[model samples]
Target: MTVRRPAHEPAEPLEERLRKLEKINRALMGRVERSTDFSGNGFSLFQTAIVLEGQVSARTSDLKRTLEDLSDAYARLEDARDDAEEAKQNLTSAIEAVSEGFALFNDAEELVMCNTPFRALLPDIETRLAPGTPFPRIAEFFSQSRHLVLDQHRSPEAWRAARIDLFRKPHAAFIQKLSQDRWIQVSNKKTDTGATVVFQTDITDIVRAERLRRERELDEQSKILQATLDHLPQGICMFASDLRLKAWNHRFIDLLSLPLRLVTPLASFERIWEWAGKSVFVHDGAGVAAVSGWLRAPSADLDSIELGKSDGSILSVSGNVMPDGGIVVSFADVTEERRASAALREAKETLEQRVEERTAELTREVIERRAIEVELIKARDTAEELTKSKTRFLAAASHDVLQPLNAARIFLSLLGGTGLDLRQQHFAGKVDKAFGSVEEVLGTLLDISRYDSGSVEANIVPLSVAEILTTLAAEFQPLADQKQLRLRCMPSGLYGLSDARLLRQIIQNLVSNAVRYTTRGGVLVGARRRGGMISVEVWDTGPGIPADKRDFIFEEFRRLNQDVPDTPKGAGLGLAIVRRIARLLDHPIAVRSVIGRGSCFSIELPLCAPPRRVEHKASAERLPVDLASFTAIVIENDLAILEGMMELLQERGMRAIPAVSIGEALETLQSLEKTPDLIIADYHLDQGTGTDAIAAIRRAAGHAIPAIAVTADQTAKVQAEIRKDHIAYLRKPIKTGDLFALIRKVIAE
Candidate 1:
């Protein structure tokens, strides 16, 4: 082989051989193209080598390598076909295992293959190998857009490398939307038989998962927004453009005690706002207007409102544009803080007013207290001065007047026993009557002194009013006769327990006043019975008491008359003495009068038990005297009084024995030899009192005789002395009737 013939064969290397084969292939291709026709000839070399002979050798030695190459290519194609079948089976099994349906269709738009799941997706189909089943038949079974692409014409490599994408057409996710509920993927390609390969994938769960993801994201964002609104201090709300409330928080609803309708669909926030604004007219309309003015705010500028709630609460409102173009409002209640501030201001004002008022009241009280203190001091000083003046007057009156009065009475009694003729007796009686008047005036002054000094203690005793009246009649009748005024005493025998001396003074004063004031008309002294009491009245028919002057007539030192013309006068003390005695006896005194009419002065005495019968009889015995057969001796030191006594005795049917001195009385008694039945001694009897004369007369007669000490001494000491001697004492200005009564009593005993 290594000969020359092998050397020629070595001329063609591996690269040269490949070139030769390519050349031969071209030649053969050209020959076949030229010689044969594809139109039913069936004798083309290319077809013959490829299909029938399977030979078109380029070189004898390269033939085996080419055959081997053809074999390996065939083996790979067989393996790929087997792998495609296995993959189809696995895909079918997987689709059946899934919950959804799946289907496969051929390029002819017919059902070629389908899994059990796909059959389930069909309405009533059993197998997938049905003929003439259109590829669009499954469109109704699927819920979304399905695509069928014929990929059977594509080589496997091309199919894998080809760009593919899937998308579900726009459709409603709900089955009621008349869209396919299930989905598939169909791929078609150009092949020898013009068929297609199709795959159907049910994508309903994927569609649902995508929708759930979107919903979860939306829910989370909404929760975030709601949480932010809730955490805000102010209440938030949304309202329609028509002013109807859509939603609200708790705070906005509770602020006004208002019905929900006001801010709800029934009424509206717009109408409620108008009403609330008008109600705020009291606190200045700015607040209400500001709240109501929010309607015109721009979207960027939030509306703000200051609201005053009906429950004394204040609210701040803010509103803004919502994403959906609705009104969103916020409110906060500030009631407690506002109330606290108002209360603080009010308390301050009240405190200031109280301070001012208290200061004014204190000033007024201080001034009033000072004025009262000064007035009290002045009153005290005036009282002291008045007390001193009264003491001096009382002392001077008793000493200067009473001493001369006592001596003159004694001289008058002494002179009465030594009387001569009627002319001499008459002259002596005139002097005695003049002196008697002076003594009577002195006794009245003593009574007034006792009353003013509060020293007149009452000696309450039971006595007969009748007897008292009778005695007063006898005492006052002569005075009444002299004044030409009738003195009538009508007595009621009413017994009363009272101060006897005071009672007598009251009656005497009443009678004396009647005589003094009366010009012509009569005076009356009487008693009448009342309920549990006796009213003793003194009535005068003279110049009647004036109505204006009646009230003050009984007051001390008060005189009803400014002028009087009577010769015998009073010191305006008679009625005053009556009032004082009435008070001392606890008797109520009253007067009734009319201008120019008569006046009546009355005393109401309370009734009490009668005294012993003996005391009553003694009082009665001293009433009126019968001077028909009585005889009395007149003894006085003064000539006038001695003569007056002798005339008075002679007039009373008594023998006259006038003595100018006590010695003359002794001579008369000795000469008479009968020791005259009674001795009439004067207190001023020629330097001896009537009491001294009584003792001297008994000494001269050498026997004790019934005698009377007649004097004007009204002092307690004088009265006590006279009582101690067991002699009757009579005060002067002694009337004829009183004198006769004393004489009769002394002689009868």
Candidate 2:
């Protein structure tokens, strides 16, 4: 390697040293000539030669040292050259291994070096793209490859011009879509030395993914728009700016009454209009021109036209201009609306005449209605008065008729206990039973009337099923025995939400019906839980009620034709009363039966929490343990009822005192030996209530004493008033056993 010295080393170098040596040799030769000329002596020549030899030896040594310096400088230059070559190879390898196509361009806009990937772009011109290749030439070769896609640049010259324009910018980047659907992100950036570096990264996957996503979104939106159009009430058809039908819903065809042949791929507004026979849009040729003008102009304001068909129907066509210069036309069939409007107009024209006629007719009707209403009011008052009379009669019978009935019942009880013959006793029993039947029928009729009048309200309360069933079992035991049919009362711990009296009456009627119908097998009355309700069912093995007759059996005075004549028939109002009571209590009553098998009558009652413990009412069969000592003050308005009650009490071994009114009861209590054990008074007395009598007698007696308010008036008001004074209540005609049991219960307390 040849080494050149650095400029800063020295102004004079090895050449300067050699030129000085030549000058020294010239001066020595001149000295030798001078010596030879001056003395022509060999000694001078010998001295000069010795000096010259010493100088030569010194100069040679200097030259040897200068040569050694040049060798060392050459070795350093070789090392630097080797390092630069290694660095060039490393840079080449780095750019070659890069994932992106990398190219370096010189300041002269010439390609200096490029990676293999960049060369791959111009595969056919790979060898031509040597170092220092002009950038324009390389770009020209690349543009000819046809792999790059250009935006707004279909021609090759335009794409190349765009690329050159971007290259001139300080820094630029653009996405290049290639043939075969490939993509490249090309970034052109400048280096510090005014050279440009370009990087092209493949983004085919990203571009494809984004495009696919957009296409899917557009497809979904198109489907949604089509669906929306299909569901629109008005018919719709959209036309492109070219007037070709782009989309249409089925309603458009239906409204236009057009044939399917006109709806082919070549369908257009002109074709349909031409086929429309010119009657739909023609208005002396002026309407046609106006419609044609608007249809041709994509930017026209919204317009609408109404058309009439030959069939006397009407169609309203409205057009809207979309942002895309397309038109959406809607067709509305307004035949009914147009006809109705015409009718309304015609009606309006004659409205005054009609109004006058209607007014006069209304006036006449008003007069007639007024007369009819007056008569209706009179009839209503009469009906209401009749209802009131019936209610009053029921109330009157409760006090007057039931008063005698109570007295009669007690007298019959006394008569039955006497020493009468068997035949006399049987007749007495029949008469007594006749009285009972009369009482039952009258009571049932009164109840039915009250229910019909909507006057009976149930007193809803939680009642123990076991207690009610037990009492009913004992009461019906004799009747069951007489009929030779088994009666079973299943004990239940369930409680039911119902009116106690109404509930008992419902059950009693059911049991009676069961016993009356059954000639053989037993009757079972029990309660069972049904979901949240308790069903009290009466199951009897008898000739079952026919499915057809079951509904009618509950009607008034309806009875099955009895085969056994011995089975005493009732008025058949028991089930009727049951139905009314069940309705009053809002309990659901139902019956299921099979022919020749049996019948089950069931009533569903809501289940309720257990009622609070209350003092049990007296058992009708029970009496006071020390009956003789138990004295009762009896107050009654009716003398007959008073006498009978006194006799009954005395018969039960109680000392009885009597009063006809509150004053009499107070006076009787004042004269009593011991404050009466119990005070029993009629609810409706001459001048006061049973509560008033009991209160007066108790005040006169100077202590709180047990009392009972007895009444044949079974009205709720009477019962509530009697119970308000904390007195036991008994309704008439009272059973003898109930009276005794009440007396026993009162005295024990």
Whole-model lDDT values for every prediction: 0.60, 0.75
What is the per-residue lDDT of model 1 for residues 1-749, given as tens digits with 9 covering 90 to 100?
11112212322243354456566656666765565334544456457546423323434435555445445444444555666678778986786786544444455557666666545544443443355676554343232222222234644334223322121211112121112543333333434554544443455565556556545633443343344344444676667666566656555555544455565643576677665555533454676666556544424324345666554567876665443346667677766545655655675565556557667687765575566557545655655556545644563355334444444554455555553334346755765764565455456666776566665567777778888888998899887887787788895768987777788878887777777777777888999888888888889876788777776677554554434434233445577778777777789988887656577878887776666664343333544556554444566766645665666566556667777777777777778847766778776566777787788888877877878877654555677788688788876545555766677787666
- Candidate 1 wrong stretches, greater than 4 Å: 1-400, 406-437, 474-488, 519-521, 555-569, 611-713, 716-718, 730-748
Which pairs clash in model 2?
none
Clashes of 1: 58
Write down the TM-score of every candidate: 0.36, 0.47
Q: On residues 140-258, what C-alpha lDDT tens digit does candidate 2 reach at each position?
A: 87678756655563777777888898987899998777777887888998888899999988888977776665456335434544554665558988888888888788898888777
Runs in model 2 lying further than 4 Å from the true structure: 1-385, 453-455, 464-467, 470-478, 486-495, 528-532, 608-624
